[model samples]
Target chain A: MPERPGQAMQKSANKRRATVADVARQAGVSVATVSRVLNAKAGDRNPVAEETCQRVRQAMQTLGYRPSQVGRTLRTQVAHVVALLIPDATNAFYAAIAHATETALRERGYAMILCNTSEDPAIQDEYLREMQAHNVAAIVLLGAVETAELRTAANSDTPIVFLNRRAPQGVPGPFIGIDNAAAGEAVGEHFAERGWARIGCIRGPQTSPASRERFEGFQSALAAAGKPLDPDLVEQGALTIESGDAAMARLLAGGHRPDAVFCGNDLMAYGAHRRLADQGLSVADVALFGFDDNPLNAWLATWLSTVHVPHSQFGRAAAEVIVELANHRGERMERQILLPFHLEVRASA
Target chain B: MPERPGQAMQKSANKRRATVADVARQAGVSVATVSRVLNAKAGDRNPVAEETCQRVRQAMQTLGYRPSQVGRTLRTQVAHVVALLIPDATNAFYAAIAHATETALRERGYAMILCNTSEDPAIQDEYLREMQAHNVAAIVLLGAVETAELRTAANSDTPIVFLNRRAPQGVPGPFIGIDNAAAGEAVGEHFAERGWARIGCIRGPQTSPASRERFEGFQSALAAAGKPLDPDLVEQGALTIESGDAAMARLLAGGHRPDAVFCGNDLMAYGAHRRLADQGLSVADVALFGFDDNPLNAWLATWLSTVHVPHSQFGRAAAEVIVELANHRGERMERQILLPFHLEVRASA
Candidate 1:
């Protein structure tokens, strides 16, 4: 029986395991040449002959030697690791973004460390500290953060990128996300174009830039259409299903029922749909508009009209910018990249 | 401004930051005393005054000293990290599991590294090698690795635990999951009791042990109830929403169109529901059963009947075992722990 085949083979092959010196000796090359071959750091510096490279490869195969990634990372001063911090990993929108970002990062030979903050700033700070301690190559933040604090903590050396949210002035990082103001304007125009006059808005938490931007855009669009802003028609809640349900209930009880409703996100829209259903009112009775065209929003039972933000594109763009920043940390940084959004007209609105 | 108040302050205040020597100096004791204080090392070879312990704590606080987790882990042979290899992060079921596992591990002071394999064996090997190289404290594998070649490479001093799947015999790891066979039997009995004589099963892929056990249990239950196993009613696919939709379409196309369907997971069940709705079939008319009572299953529209596996408990138990092994690497290991599952009867069934 091959007891511990993997372990025994590795142990018995060579007691000390092949080092750069051993490979150099076996391949009849200098230690520097062996290091260059193993680390892929030669890069037009003292290029080796094709025959010598082949001999080095053969020597490595014979010795069963695997180069140390940690050592290489330290020597290069690049960890090849990026940290992604999201408010919640269970949310489909964020999960999809994380999936896309992970694929992009992997293609670029980088590993991602996923941290779930559950919308708690303390947890976010802890994760940020941990990432800094690990010397993460770059960071992609998906949720809102206090601008001054985040900017101070991030400093200039660490490349930071924002996704689904915008950073404050002078943050020195690229922001990749949908044009929230445009999305909100589209929703407002859709409601107006459909001749639904009375509109109520359920906004996300006040701290989020996405929420604030959308609210401003919606208000501006309504004003342009000669409609006065009704404070009684607005309700504020967290961007969660339960919060949405609660906000909708409050709107219903306040006696300012509108014929149309615009929600901050799809999860909230689903909650509003359920609440309306519970009240014996169908979604068709009140036109509903949601943002972030998540997968669940397209279900047959709930064909939600939503602003389709290109989630995958957002992720890919963020990854590309961060990778560039990682390559050149001290260069002048790009400010922001606003991706376009489309309106998915479904039966709901 | 407090520059990097968390860890950086401590590192900068003292030239070398909180080393074993610094701790000893503050405690008015030997270097070994501080090492014992941090590691909780066994054997009390030195005695220190209670006042001295207090002074040590005060000094650490004043200097903003945080112990080097890396150094302690190195000396104690405990990395304080666990690697979780998941099939996919986009799947809500898997995401929920990963979320719960991460929370559990974090509460126990263990960091989790989530690696998405995308159901590829080669990628799984790459992640396994990365984990081994990091000297992760333990590993929790969520997918099946059939080939002995890959298994042979997993020989490490770190403990490993299998989740949602069973490893081959003599594999050096504990298996933590529900009794899939029993859950399937329960599903079969539920279908039979509900008077759905004609039933179809959207079985998972054959490579997974959970799928095999579930199929066996379902077949055994049907046989005991005098219902012959109908080969035509079975459609094989992966445990994904798209696969479930394809499998359902196949079943409908076949001559045997059962009134009820049992899906391998909740995502698949949701897909089945979507397909049925597209075909103008009401959920109430055709009963559907799913496994893993995911949070989304409890939504009003998708009140899916499912087998409730304590996912959080699974994570907690796995972390506990890993922490135990990390603390005592040489101790005799426990082989397996089977968790209990319950049937959650909802509107679908």
Candidate 2:
């Protein structure tokens, strides 16, 4: 909307920083004219009036108007935007990662367009195309849902960074994930030390690479310790609290009850713990472990031992990689970024 | 990056959607030429080879290429992007709102740029100016922090929607908020139904208008019931679990023993519940209430009674209003939107 007579007075009354529009108003020029001067370049062919340019610059100085990188982004066509695709933001794990990524990108004067894909490959594909069409700087896929659309996006002109999940089968891209196998092995070893003879596990969705890797590495460690994981003790379900509760209920109804159980994520662990509590059992009787040590572990659900995936580190690294790739500054180094994880042994385990 | 040799072969191997660049390649024309043809106006004066336009159109048909709105955004200088300013996305309240807002905007072919300011006015200012310079379709401030920058942005050209908080000071803008004061009164009356004589309250940050409104409404209800709120029983703290815990601890240590307590949000109630549990007391003994009924109520923290604030409604309304205002359809009507709330009576109360 065009500014009215008293709008400038209202703006000044509110302490709004001067914008190009403000500069344009003072210089008696158009907003586009002001932008042209702000984004003036060497060897530029377009001829702008010298007097007009000086007036715009003088107006900027008088108003303390610091031009934003937006003009440059328009000149380049590609927006300073990174579309972050996460399965669900309601999950604290994704929320933390999104927060970190937003912080990192904002520091570089970039904006993050967050998408909640709901673990559906179709949703993921839709967002992927829209982001590409908008000429976003990059796309960060968190726990990417493997689809044919993703396979093509992997090799598109825009760069993609995968978190927790590796590149969709065979395509090469900048991938960021943790040493989940090692973390799982460590958890297995810690469980063995706790003297729990009958250990069970509640795995997340089988589609998730992280969940599969965690379970596989766990079995490897158990086998090495002369105690192969009992096949009857494992139950697979979605990564939700309800699924975890049902899985735990099934585990209890089975013939051989496990003394300790590990879940795919914290939500699953909470469900498992709640089920046990309802059954007049406690973490003291059946130890539990979960993944993704949410920041609120200490305040709520402190008993469930969990693995701390450095969400901030994941976000920062993803943002750094995206920015570099978007600017064409990264083409060789650090294609596969592997972060570390640690087990938080709480009272539950 | 330009498509390398055989990159098309790889792209074909995958199911990637064809972009404008692909159209340019198939037609053997410059990318700019393809864009010009895609964006041809009713009276385009630039003379171009009719054969070239036909070839470009044929390439688009062969590739099943659907031109995106990006070209229109470029021509108009206003991308279909909305800036959502949130205090923190990690909180389930804000996270839910963000998710809903994202969904609504996505349906409208717009993207949301989430900004987590952590209640800092300075950071909010930086993001405001940046969004303005980028010419975002609108700015949605969730629990807006009162700042001069905010006051100015309230009157800026770009549409601004205030949620949870009204416009800074006296500035006029569209707002989406629940009837918090009425919700508080409902909670107060409900507490009286539970036959709790000694009732206490824990408030959120003093800067938040919602918190103040909620408290004032609660006091009004209590006074009507001939049990005016006791100042000694009230504790003001931040909207954090730790703050909630500290406030509960202080209430417990006070001279009066309250049988029921109301908190600003569910997190605070969780903290209070945990504190009571730590002291070997259950909600059955000391009733508790909270606000913003998180979706995880039944699965986790089932005992903490709360008020159900319609976060999805807030997001949807904000999105609808912003879209209307940004597109210049909303000059008046429904400017101050007030959503509804309900009392969720859990075992805690």
Candidate 3:
């Protein structure tokens, strides 16, 4: 009988510690039988005769034996684990996605192991290798897979689903995310409708599919509207607050300042908002539009107009895809899941 | 040589693909040598000499031969992994911590496995067990250990360092975090000096040490000011925007609203800000204070007054401690480190 912490403390206080022998005696079973039952391994050993198993179980319950998970994991090959690789966990957008994904994973009896790649292709490969070594059942990649190395590694045996990212053509896997290109087009139309002609865009990293697709859609929309897309007005940044701040600062320093600014993500928009405010310009004064309708944007203080990615659904769908793949054992069709994105108009832009 | 995707596209436009042997033949290497190098096992075999190693490396680099991580993990016992378990990754505060921690861990040649526990003790325990099963070197637990089960499980052989959460007395390990009690006292003193008559506080989850310490410190400072602390004024919430909103709503509904509100964390403050705003109340109208000076709070839109928990330092220190423990396998040190916290007063409070 393994004494639980609560019972141990109580017994120590009362000087009535119960031993494994005592439990065995009470159950009319051998110490080994009692031990096996407490460890949840009775199912593996000769079915334990139902009456005896019942007695052993009752003994463990009365003795308050808390089975050690450490011991159990060592015996079981299935760790009930999965791995999630993302650009950064601290970004609220990614974090929200991770949080939702974790919740869904846990409900499905899977534990998630997370990796922060920081958009570095090398680091991403390293984490991928590590996750593989852990025998993670599946992987959910939340950022762009830049190098061919990552794609090839993922293609072999791992049931990978992309979250907030898209696999290139010929990559056999499911990608669960919003249509970045369409979202960008919507942003451009929103700006054009608002009569903001001279728009400056702070794009995300060029390597990311999201950044490229969004840029393509925005450019297409601007071209359709007969607006010349100024290459000078466009600047690339990593999807980060600091990067956004730096890009916005550089844009401000440049001689030509556009009336409206479209940021790749909401965090970047917030950064642009800060820079504008520091320059004695408020959000209302210099219209700012951002991608990812983060919950913070809805707050009165930051009322950031943005595009809303179905973050929770993206996560749920990704998990479902992975679970489906796991159950079918690689027999399911390769899915390209593109959830919808909403344009949320607020006070900022 | 493995044909480049571009060249392949140009050649066939639509073909299934060449095999690994074909790539080896093109690269001018034996099939076995190519297999060893592509599998990331060049160092293990003597069959491929140094010159051959370089040639294969260059060929794979040019040919873009990415080995499957799943196959490698199945063969090797070394996962080269560690887990960074956080309460909420989307919360900028936790996200920043996780990013820094991952960076530190990666630099040490360990892959970071991220787990968003959502402050759920059960989920936290499940993740911890999973990490152990995967043979992770160590675990860095961020935020609060919300369950007694997790607290006990943390005390096992698996090395764990609690980030931003204080362990119970005599836990026999170091807990790296800022002094929440002192931070709360600082907020109390700030409110006292500002001459706020009635002070309200939004505490975090009851299970968290941060909430208890902050509550204690706030109570002490208010007691020193001879201001009768109203039990009804304190509201409990999960460290989230929604929880903060709901708690504030409860506070207002209870009709025990104070002149100023001190939040356990920034997200909650942001949430409370939203509720107050929706109710047509300005932050300036009712003073607000928050903890964890997250990057978002520093934004011009937020400008929230907060207690700055050295975000990077928290992650760095925790990583340093775990790395130290891992290096000295036989040595044991029960250390308790308390980092400093600073108060940042902005336009909001």
Give all candidates' CA lDDT scores: 0.74, 0.81, 0.72
lDDT leader: 2
For candidate 3 chain B, which ten residues in a row score worst on lDDT?
A: B1-10
Q: Write the per-residue lDDT of candidate 2 for residues A1-349, one digit (tens) a residue.
A: 2111332112222345577899999999999999889878877799578999999999999997976445555456577888999998978888999999999998887888899999887889999888887678888999887788887776666678888787756866777878778888888888888779999999987777788888888889888888888989999878777888999999999977799998888888878887898899998888999998976575468676899888898888888777767656224223777787888888888
TM-scores of all predicted structures: 0.85, 0.84, 0.68
TM-score of chain B of each: 0.89, 0.82, 0.74
Q: For residues B1-349, what per-residue lDDT tens digits would candidate 2 score against the true structure?
A: 2111322112222345577899999999998899888778778889557999999999999997866545656456566888999999998888999999999998887888889999888999999888887668888888787778776666666667888887766776767887778888998888777778889999887778889889888889888888898899999868777888889999989967689999988888877877888888888777889899986565467766799988888778887787777656224223667787888886778
**Could you give candidate 3's per-residue lDDT for residues A160-270 as a string of tens digits?**
677777776676556778878988998887777778767899999877788889988888888788785788888888777788788888888888777888899887887
- For model 3, residues B1-349, the per-residue Cα lDDT tens digits are 1111321111112222233566687679777777766655535645567787788777766655545333333344334567878877776777788778877776775667778776777777778766665556677777656466565545555566777786655554467777778788888888888888777889997777778899789889888977756888889888888999998898888875678899988889878888998889878777889888887665433578898888887766766777777765434445556777788898877
Candidate with more favorable, higher DockQ: 1 or 3: 1
Return the top candidate by DockQ.
Answer: 2
DockQ, in order, for the candidates? 0.20, 0.28, 0.16
Candidate 2 docking: what grade? Answer: acceptable
- Which scores greater on DockQ, model 2 or model 3? 2
